[model samples]
Target: MLITIGIIIGLLIVAYFAFVNFYPSFGGDVSKERQSQYTDSSQFEEGKFKNDKDVPKDPTFSEILSMTRKFFFTKVEKGRPSEELPNHTVDSLSLVSYHGGTRLMWFGHSAFLLQMNGKNILIDPMLGEVPAPHPLLGAKRFNEELPIAIEKLPKIDAVLISHDHYDHLDYKSIKSLKNKVNQFYVPLGVGVHLEAWGVPQDKIQELDWWQDTSLEDLRFVCTPAQHFSGRKFSNGQSTLWASWVIQSETESIFFSGDSGYANHFKEIGEAYGPFDFAMLECGQYNKLWPDIHMFPEETAQAGIDLKANVIMPIHWGAFKLALHSWTDPIERVAIKANSLGLPMIAPKIGAMIELNSLLANHQEDWWD
Candidate 1:
């Protein structure tokens, strides 16, 4: 009997190894040579990337068990939307023909396409149907269709990735987008995954926090974010996570990529104040992990700290990663923003946003 139990345990261990190794979505490993380059970064230490603050502390065994129980056993009312979200289909001809000023389009959750200074850039384009290594392991996306198909996208000037989390950095999306993108800008240690996925090493550029790089007239700054990164269970924090500062001479934009509330917003504002627009993460939050993902009110406050001329709440209205109601994030944030007299815009999925119109506080509560 004991031998049979041991055999069962051995088989389980082998299966786990095989799955992680054979699965393309688990991502690639960072070579020792590549990891050595990160030693100079203050955020890199003890062979893994570290946050500025000692946030995201590992939960204890009891805490983990409790969370697991709550997730699998506890029912969350309205955790997902009752109906499919409404979105505007992107006109491919318009995208190709329009030579207007800077514009933006949200592709639900943390994905966006930005046209600035004659360049087309994609930010954290996780357009996959599921935010998991395998589709069966995750819930379906709220929106069944993307505004534009990945194949329909025009030639891309650059792709900016915030981190390697599955929800933010999807493998299928990258495979579809890579051939068309001229450059990929990712946080330190993240390029290895792209390189492993057949992206040429030369086409990828990796940056440490506060590091700045430019393509033509545009400046891309890899700024700080209070978050963690991992694609699989064993490799947490092996890579870095970040917010981004994108700037043309005329427009400045900030994208807070999956961050908790932190003083980094004020620091970013001080260094690069009065941004033309900012996209702040405002969802998938719970009290269990307060330090990693901000509550909704914190999202509004983050806008004030960034000194943004206008702010849009993102990271919600798409997936059910947390226990809150589907609309809780935007609802709470809008109230706080109104009380603070901060201009906030909450466009529907796939809505085209003219940068100039943001100053007039363009908003759509389409979730209602």
Candidate 2:
């Protein structure tokens, strides 16, 4: 029995080492490259990008392991969520080109189908049922399939990635999209993982904070997001995490990928402010990682930071990434924005919101 136990222990050590070595540590600019055409990082003054020390202390693996393991290994918890299919069918916003031009369809979590200037962009596409590589390691997938399936998706022009967290970056999603995606805009070390998953080196575009490039008529600027990334050990800062600015002739959109409160928004707003619409993060927040995520109130504050005229709360409403009631985010954001007189829309799942005409009439508590 001791001999058998010894063999098992040896295997675990090997597996653990493999995990550490598999993902590169967060450190350098190996996969990240700077572009010469990129000039001003942001239009704002100093202190725009919040630093690491300001970010809230994340739950060390030791701090949350028991809960994580119990949740993962035990069946005491039901495998699925209780929320029903949201009644909001996506409102079809007509594109300038029926095929494209500044429109987005949220697929849940931080993923969206963004079309601008005739280019189809997919952002942080995590359409998988579960965020884990296998069912054994993580929580169950969101109860609903992405409003649209990957296979059925129209040809994509590019993929904008925020970071390497399993929730934001799904290996299975990338693998399936390898042949379909024309280009990938990702943070530094993220390309390494994508390469391992069968993505080509030429197709992946890595940008540092504030770097940007033009694609066709659409322009993509990688902005800073206050967050961290690591799918495995030793890769804490290997890859960067950031938001994105999508701009075109008729419309400009700001996406706050996953960030805590920061002064960068004002800078972004000034530089790319007066956005027609903004998709802001407003979910899975807790006091533990306070600086990494903005509370529902803070999410609204972020909208103001980007000077968004019409805003829709993403990140929440899709996945139960936090312990709050499923509806807490939308409900709280509605209350806060209403009180602050912030122009906002809380569309139900799949609901289409038209930015051009909302001042006259809009739905009330549809999610309620």
Candidate 3:
């Protein structure tokens, strides 16, 4: 009986390894050369990337079991919209042809198509229906359709990725977008996954935190974010996570990619303050992971920290990644932003936003 039990344990270990290794969605391993590249980054140490601020402490076996019980058994109220969300079709022609001013379009959540300085750039373009590796493993996206289908998109000049989480760095979306995109800019060690998915090494440029690179006249700076990274259970923090600072000759913008409340926002603001617009994560938060994802009020404060003239709450209105009500994030954030006299635009999923006219396009309470 003891020998049989030992054999079962051995089989289970083999199965776990096989699933993570063989699964394409789990992403690729960082090569030794790539690991060597990370050695210079202050954030990379002991063979994994890290946040400078404190993150959640590792849970004990009992604590893990308790959280697992709550996750599987607890009933969350209004976790998703009761009906399909209203959305607008993408004006692909205008998007492709326009060079008059910098325009932005949110494809729900953190995904965006930023047209600036006569160039088309995609930021965290996770257009997949489910955020998980498999369709059955995650909830369906609230909106049934994207503003513009992947096939309908025009040639992309560049793509900016913040991290390698499945929700942020989707495999199917990358596969569909790889050919259309001219270049991919990702955080350190994230290129391994893109390369594994068939993107050419030459097309992928990886940067450490505070690193800056340019595409034509526009500037892209990889900034810090207080978050962890991992697609599989075993490989947590193997890659780096970051926010981004995008600047054109005329306008500067910030994208806060899944960060908790930290001084990094203030630091970024001081280094590159007075942004024209800011898109910040404002959803999928809970007390269980408070160190990683900020609450609604914190999102408002982050906008202030960035010294942004206009802010839009993102990382919500798409997926039910947290137990909060579907509209809780926007509702709570609106109150905080209003009290702070901060200008925020909460547009519909596919609404076109002209950066210069943000105040005029102040979105109504559509989520209500």
Candidates' TM-scores? 0.97, 0.81, 0.96
Ranking by TM-score: 1, 3, 2
**Clash list (residue pairs), candidate 3:** none
Candidate 2 has what TM-score?
A: 0.81
Identify the runs in model 2 with alpha carbons over 4 angstroms from their true place: 1-10, 18-62, 65-81, 87-101, 358-364
**What is candidate 1's lDDT per residue for 1-368, written digit by digit as tens?**
99999999999999989999999988898777878899999999887898889988988999999998887677888888888888889988788877899999999999999999888999999999999899988888998999999999999999999999989999999999999999999999999889878899999999998999999999999999999988877888999999999998888999999899989999999998789899999999999999889899999999999999889999997788888988999999999999989989988788788898875535657788
Model 2 has how many clashing residue pairs? 10
Better of 1 and 3 by TM-score: 1
> How many clashing residue pairs, candidate 1?
0
lDDT of 3 by residue, 1-368 (tens): 99999999999999879978898888898876778878999999888888886575677899889877876677889888999887989877877778778888899989999988888899999999999888988888998999999888889999999999988999999999999999999999899899989999999999999999999899999999999998887778989999999998878999999999999999999999899999999999989999899899999999999999999999999998887888999999999999999989899988889888998965788987
Q: Worst ten-residue run, lDDT, model 2?
A: 41-50
lDDT of 2 by residue, 93-203 (tens): 332236423456667667877766667788888777676545555556554555655766667789999887777888778878879899999865567777777788899
**Model 3 spans > 4 angstroms off:** 1-12
Residue-level lDDT for 191 in candidate 3: 90
lDDT agreement with native, every candidate: 0.91, 0.70, 0.91
- Candidate 1: residue 355 lDDT (0-100): 94
